[model samples]
Target: MSRFVDIRIDPAIVRRAARGDARAHEIIYRAFSAPVYSIGLRFTRVPAHAEDLTQETFVEVMRSIGSFRGEAPLGSWIRRIAISKALMLLRSAWQSRGQQLDEGWEDFTPQRGQDGNAAPDATIDLDSALAQLPPVGRTVVWLHDVEGFTHREIAALMGKTESFSKSQLSRAYQRLRPMLQVDEEELADSKTTAGTVLGSC
Candidate 1:
């Protein structure tokens, strides 16, 4: 018998999907497609590869859903699948056809401090700057800042040292900060000017 599931039954849906329930499987797929795609892109940095990972990830997820114990959030479960898919692709590329990666993006260390508390207006939208980082640096920063993983966890996941994770975060910030050349004082001044103009008008 096929079981219909709402988002509330995420765990049940996962279980049933693992057992091949078509309806529950659809719910699971729709729930995690965007995050799987976005994270796949982050890992692979190729749009086409990301698309493939998204599909492959869902397939893997469905295959393994019954084993999911709900120990972590559903999203985390799906993310693990996506990361695994991307890494598998990387491995296959290396083994089958040999792949070359630029080494210049490595050996980066952040010149900035690790204190999360930068001054007011300190948080810069450095998405573009992040794109310029070496893929490893960007991955470290995204996993740390965006995904909220600890250095130890990231090191474990990437097979690097905690110090390497810290250094990558630093390098990513240094490369990013220059792109956000505006100072806190400048941002404050602009805000004040805008406020004054709006107040007068």
Candidate 2:
């Protein structure tokens, strides 16, 4: 999925966009909007804030399209803009609380799955599980795993050290492992039960 999003677009369309062709601009916007908004939501965990960031990202994209060399995929360029805008919002919010961004990590306990059951394995919802993570943890996991950003890239985006991104990703995986293991065990049990029933029949 990440590879698909990072696929290169036609240079002609980009040139047309850089020249202020409205149709070309719209095409680019329509193609990249979902992924951009997804990054926003994953980072902010708020639909409204995500929408605002998406708009801001596109605005920046349009303004800077003239300078967009074909060195990288247009989607990659837009993703950087989206990440920058989202990080700006996060930084502002943290500052408003008179808090330092380098503060210690807070302990995160995985919440029950959407089914209100202790065994999250019964209902394996990746998005639900990801959403349950704290903002910093969720951003690290999504950027590293979903968006295919390197730990160093993520650290630069978050204005933290590479070690911070690595540590946060490690913590997120630690919390997610048990929840995912439960689902694997459940699948094995179901297959065994099915085999036994067939044998009895």
- Taking the tens digit of each residue's C-alpha lDDT, what string does model 1 give over 1-201? 001111244466667787799998888777767667777776677889889889998878877777888886777767766766775665466446444322435444333435543333334444544555666666666666655568998777766689988887766555655455554454234233222322122
Cα shift from native, residue 92, model 2 (Å): 1.9
Candidates' lDDT values, in order?
Answer: 0.61, 0.72
Question: Residue 124's C-alpha lDDT in candidate 2?
Answer: 47
Q: What ranges in model 1 sit over 4 Å off?
A: 1-9, 87-102, 106-125, 182-201
| lDDT tens readout by residue for model 2, 32-124 | 888788778767888999999999999999999999997877887888888899989988887887766654246456665567554645244
Residue 80, candidate 1: Cα error in Å is 2.1
- Which ten residues in a row are the worst by lDDT in model 1? 1-10
**Candidate 1 collision pairs:** 110-170, 110-171
Clashes of 2: 0
